[model samples]
Target chain A: MHSLTRSFLAVALLASVSAAHAHRTWLLPSAAQVDGKDPWVTVDAAVSEDLFELGANALKLDGLSITDPDGGSVQPNQTSTGKYRSSLDLKLAKSGTYRISLVSETAMASYKLNGEMKRWRGNVADLKKEVPAEAEELSVSTTLGRLETFVTAGKPNGTALKPVGSGLELIPLDHPSEFLAGQPARFRLLLDGKPLPGLTVAVVPGGVKYRGVLKETALTTDAKGEFTVNWPTPQMYWINAGYPARVNVPEGQPRPPMPAKRYNYSGTFEVLPQ
Target chain B: MQKRKLLLTAVLASALPALAAELSVKIDIPQLAVAEYHRPYIAMWLEKADGGQVTQLAVWYDQKKKDNGGTKWLKDMRQWWRKGGRDLEVPLDAVTSATRAPGLHALNFAAGKAPLGQLAAGEYTLFVEASREAGGREVVRVPLSWPPKEARSTGSKGQEELGNVTVQLKP
Candidate 1:
């Protein structure tokens, strides 16, 4: 293999190792909070390690949907996709919290001979599933990714923000609109309405432009399915949390412990400076 | 393993009410020594092991108070407020009631019913958060399993405002 290609594979392996199971699909707004007078927020959606830096690559926005504070739909004006990033612009008309949600279609592929999964950008087919006879024996499956974020104009009016998605969900008990810097914020995580304990919820300050290794402060929820994160500083914070689904083998199938399906849930809420 | 699996399938397919599960919660309100003591606002809800909120069972406050002033202190039950309290309007029927006097108060709901019945089968935590006016705040959590594969119950004790909280899931 060429030196460049070999180094690229090394980086991918290193990134995957460091992230563990971090197929985090997050929706990041240019600004989580904006002035009501001229409220316009740019949103970036991606399946990546640090929200939307394109460290892995850009994810397609086929199932992208944005709802304004008044429950009206906000359309993306300009959408441009690059090797690493996909950007869109949203016009914020009303003065409330706008919810952005993107549901990626399921992308599946066979595992490498060494049992490691291959990385691919955008949506693609599982060649192994298509031609089973010609494909490898063992395979990997990733469930659809669900990403969501919230932005606000004026003070967070507490409108249009509800946990209705079917993925691993984080429901902010405190209003995300009223987050203050340095104050602790509490959130509850649930999968199918059940409190998920021991979830590693990470909070990253700023959007993709964060410098110095993308420092993220993470905390694990207690037995009560709750976590309190004290934002180190007041800035636009992207809080990402998720878990993998259990793998159930069929009744008569040889149980070699199949790989579990993974799901990613993410959101962005700003903690304004006091 | 096979027998247990078959039994689980049979129970899931059974139409008999004997398979129905019932959730009962007992919350103790401690009588504290303080001047002008008022009953604390209490909120109870079910959450999955992953922290997903199921359905809220009840919120006890002075709903009958004039000007809806009792709700102003509801935020003091900080855990419940972020879980689902802030999303709801005050005086939610069947879910909101006046605070109970200091004692062990019991609330029951049958499975396949509105609140508890709406719950998807899973292991859950019953969170009971209490915040009193001119008093301390406390929260207690008890683990519970629904669609009672087997009859089970769990309980926990609170520090100050709240006392013992017991959750029983009966088949």
Candidate 2:
């Protein structure tokens, strides 16, 4: 009985680890700020367990979008996907801020059919037609996630920072490219164009391998959906926040109904030394 | 009494020009003994005491590069770039010049001039930042009280990228 209990605990631990600490997706720019008459920035897209160290899997670029300083859609000059990361070059003709993002939306469901558990994933519009009508113990959920970063060719501007009014968004009170070490930077969180309060934001600085410590800082938004981060040093940082924290149920107990939808937002920012 | 008051106003107005101060800045670019050396890019500007406003004084870079390639490295002067340099169009005829050799350089500006003409009478700070291609970066600051109460000098020193930097105010 003791050995069985030990094995059960091990299984529980594994489940929690996989659910809570899944791989993180990010987009890293070659330079957050550039100069000169004609400037171009290269971006790397990847998913890895470690922060900013691209070795796990290349993040697909199908949903890639680039917003120029004028709030107009722009295309990447060149793109390539390798085993570990995807890279793209974007020419910045205008002299202001640009937004690069990977946006995706999908539907996921699980149900018991013929006493066997089945799962399906597809676009939201195909959910009804794909899933069987008589499936038992059916549960469905939708996910919308955005991973983004900002680059400024010359003077930074706010034209490309307007929220899309659908999923989670980060609005910077202080210009992202102007962040300095030991200084506090403010940002507001929104959901569906409205303020999202009391959400926890995880800020992890890059160079985890050299530091040997995660040094992740957790900040909670106030009533106004605003949070501030005091950067520790000059380096690239990843900021992430998600809604609907995972719930753990006891064994032999029926799992509670999961939330119908989930939203996630993450951005990479570079901080300079004072 | 009205005639006397009019005469007093004219006297004060005429004295204003005489009170105008002249600012002289001397910057020293150090010569480094390294395997590879490139002349450092420099940016000079004056900021209000509270750091509210900035007036660019001069920028020394490789103006002769083909297709204006020299401006590409101007961002290496990170502090100046973030403060106000990034927005400026390089090769500005008024304040832009070619890179200088390793020596003491003097720049003089009159109080009633184009760049300093609009400056208000108050405390101000001068910033001189330098960044080299294959070397280090440094910044030197000097403080001044505009329309000087008396002639005075203030300066700062940089260890590696620069040498003695002095600012003189003459009434």
Candidate 3:
């Protein structure tokens, strides 16, 4: 029993370390809700674990797509890509909710048994066809990080607040446009159309340009996959949450090879000042 | 005499938009009776009725200083910094200038120029945000309709950081 506890502790430590290093993509807009008079809302997007440091070096723009309120496609142009920041701007033409989503291409990580120790090297897609299947038990994992946010113009009365389909999604319990400073905003996490509970949700006070470390208030969801954060000040915030899936070689059951999966979700909302 | 008459008509045609779309902004850098009085960084831009950026009219900071020292303080103007100011390399041609002192200053943009040229016959909100060192910050958003519809002019009074701000969009 003591040895089993020690092994469990070791596994827990490894999971915590990996979670700390996981990168997330964040999409932030200038305003969560705009009145009829304001013509546009500028959105800033980046892939990074730390909000201040955008991972432009490894980040690609091919996965970005925006669906406007009128069921039209709105393209966001890459405005700038500095060393620590990458930004995009969108021209909000009509009044309704705009959905900005980033769907990344799958990245593979594989480890091979070399003599006694397993060495993680090269892309699994390339190595799988070359490496001999008898020489190793391949443990490969595929990761697809997704980020999305919804902003409205005029009012959110007719806007659809339900899921528009994503691997992991955080839908605001109430209208995001109604979020005001000093109010507790609630959101529900969904994984495959069901509630996801006991996950860590982080809320960063400022947007990507915030020149500081990743200091955020971490909150946990309840049994119903709901979490709340009381915004003290009126400012831009990036809320992030993630989940992982792991599967191994089946016991006596023949099934096709499957890679483990990890899904990350991030959303940005503004707590309007009074 | 025909040549002179043609010249007069051409000049009037060119000046038509300028007379139609005019913005007279009065930014007062409050004279704080203090020792370390660094001029505040100010930015003026127009946004469409839906919150889209129209054009940046002027951004005043310490441009002449070497090594781009003045830009370091622009983050103090939070709203503009997030909008589009951070992407702009300081000392931008025709758009950047030195900081002003406490008084009323005038800025005129001709038709077929920034803002006026980009104006697409719609409603707009003029945003003026200012930030100072060791001082308070303020943002003023003014509302206006494009093409003036009928020579419409609007103005607003700042509480502390700025003075009477007026904009005229004529037809």
TM-score on alpha carbons, each prediction: 0.47, 0.56, 0.48
Predicted complex 3: CAPRI docking category: incorrect
- Candidate 2 displacement at residue A92 in angstroms: 0.5
| Error of model 3, residue B60, in angstroms | 45
List where candidate 2 sits over 4 angstroms from the true fold: A1-21, A122-134, A246-256, B1-171
Candidate 2 per-residue lDDT over residues A1-274, each given as its tens digit: 6444334433444343333335678999998999998999999999875678886799889889999999999999999999999999999999999999999776677766886666677667788899999897666777788999999998999999888787998998999988999999999999999999988788878886555334667788999999999999999999988776444444445444446788888899999999
* lDDT at residue B140 of model 1 (Cα atoms): 86
* Candidates, DockQ: 0.01, 0.01, 0.01
- Writing each residue's lDDT as its tens digit, candidate 3 over B6-112 gives 99999998767655565555555555432123466789987887758657778999775668877877876788888888787777776888888777777776556
Over the stretch A1-274, how does candidate 1's per-residue lDDT look in tens digits?
A: 4444444454444334223443455666777778856788887766654444566677677778887877777787778777776778877777788888887645444333343435532243544344345333334445555677777888776556666646677788787777897788889887766888976766766543333123456678789789998877776666666465222233334333323355666677777788
Proportion of true inter-chain contacts also present in candidate 3? 0.00
lDDT value, candidate 3, whole model: 0.65
Record all residue pairs in model 2 with backbone atoms less than 3 Å apart, i.e. clashing. Answer: none
Ranking by lDDT: 2, 1, 3
Mind listing the fnat for each candidate?
0.00, 0.00, 0.00
Ranking by TM-score: 2, 3, 1
Higher-lDDT candidate of 1 and 2:
2
Residue range B104-154, candidate 2, lDDT tens digits: 999998877856775787788889998776345778888888877777888
